[model samples]
Target: MRWTVHGERTILDTPWVRLRSLDVEQPDGARVAYDVVRLRDLAVATAVDDQQRVLMMWRHRFVTDTWAWELPMGLVEDGESPEAAGARELEEETGYRPEVMRELIYAEPAAGITDSRHFVFRAEGARRVGEPSERNESDRLEWIPLADLPGMIARREIVSSATLVGVMALLLDLRA
Candidate 1:
């Protein structure tokens, strides 16, 4: 069963987010206006080192009023590939350049109401290039041992859905 989308009306449009009301008919024959959030595709870089540590930042999200660890990530600009965007964010936010990068996973954190896409990439190892060009990104940067992920997650220290999904996929890859 699939829902029928009759039409959509833009409620608010912005460079970062778009709000829209969709006229949809459910499989059960009920029609209603459903609100959806549209966001730019996000590119996330999970850089790891030879020491088996993953690069991360401790940052505060004002919207949630919470602090957590997150990977270097940003919106994918128009005409840029997800990989390229991930690389740019990694360098800008962390001052590290990946020697090699590859796709790890893709996730839609809130697909039920948002068309946002998350492109997660794994950077095998990185080398420090210079100071981060994008300031105020985070409070501290660290190469966190992968072994600490479970504990960090258990303590609610890593809360971003993108980071959670990416790390879980990485952990699964390790088992494979």
Candidate 2:
């Protein structure tokens, strides 16, 4: 059984997000309203080097009040393709350029109440160009060994949803 959305009303709209109140009807003939958050799609880059290391950013999320390692990512701006945004964010945040990039995974972090999508790209043969264009994006940037990821996740040090998904997908592909 599927829920039918009869209509929607905008509760809040802004450049960053849109909150909608949906008028929906269930298969059981029950009608109700649901609120959903809509956000611009995010592009995430997982860059791996020749030495089996991944370029990552050590950053603090104010909302979560936690510091963790994360893949370089950002919202896809208007008219920007997710691949282009992934490559752009990789360089902007980590000062590394992807010699090759391909889509690795696509995910939605919170499906129950949000329409946010994440496009994760696998980048190989990354080279450092210079300092990051956006220094404020992270406290420190480092190349962490891919083998160390399982321990980091177990320690709760790599906690970003997109980062976790992207890294695990790449790891699984590597293992296979």
Candidate 3:
């Protein structure tokens, strides 16, 4: 069963996010207004080297006041493909350029509240170039061993949704 959207009014509009009030009739015959946050699509990458180490960043999210390890990611700009954006973000955030990028998985984190799509890619290898193009994005960048992923996750050190999904998918793909 699907809900029928009768109308939608913008509550807030910005380059990064758009908030809307949607008037809809549910399949259960209830009509209501729902607030939704719409976000631009994101491109995320998991870059792994030949030594079985995955490139990661240790960062803090002020909103949650938490520090965790995450993959390189950014919003997909207009006119830029997800793969291109992923490659750009990987380099800009970590100074590592992907040698091979393949789609790992896509995730919608909060479908009920936000229409945010994350395009996750896996890079079989990467090479470090110059310094990172952008600073203050992370406290440290490290090439973590693949065998340590489960421990990191268990320790709550790898907490970003996109990173978790991408890494798990890549692991599964590797097994296949």
Q: What overall lDDT goes with each candidate model?
A: 0.93, 0.92, 0.91
Query: What are the per-residue Cα lDDT tens digits for candidate 3 across 35-130?
Result: 999899999989988888889999999989999999999999999999999999999999888888899898999999999999999965788887
RMSD per model, one decimal: 1.0, 1.0, 1.0
TM-score of model 2 vs. true structure = 0.97
What is the Cα-based lDDT of residue 161 in candidate 1?
A: 93
Model 3 CA deviation exceeding 4 Å by range:
none
Candidate 1 — worst ten consecutive residues by lDDT sum? 167-176
Better of 1 and 3 by lDDT: 1
lDDT of 2 by residue, 1-39 (tens): 789999999999999989999999989999999999999
* TM-score, cand. 1: 0.97
Reference-based TM-score of each model: 0.97, 0.97, 0.96
Q: For model 1, how does the per-residue alpha-carbon lDDT over 1-176 read when each residue is reduced to its tens digit?
A: 99999999999999888999999999999999999999999999999888888999999999999999999999999999999999999999999999877999999999999999999999876899998999989859999999999999999999999999888888777788
**Error at 132, model 3, angstroms:** 0.5
Most lDDT-accurate candidate: 1
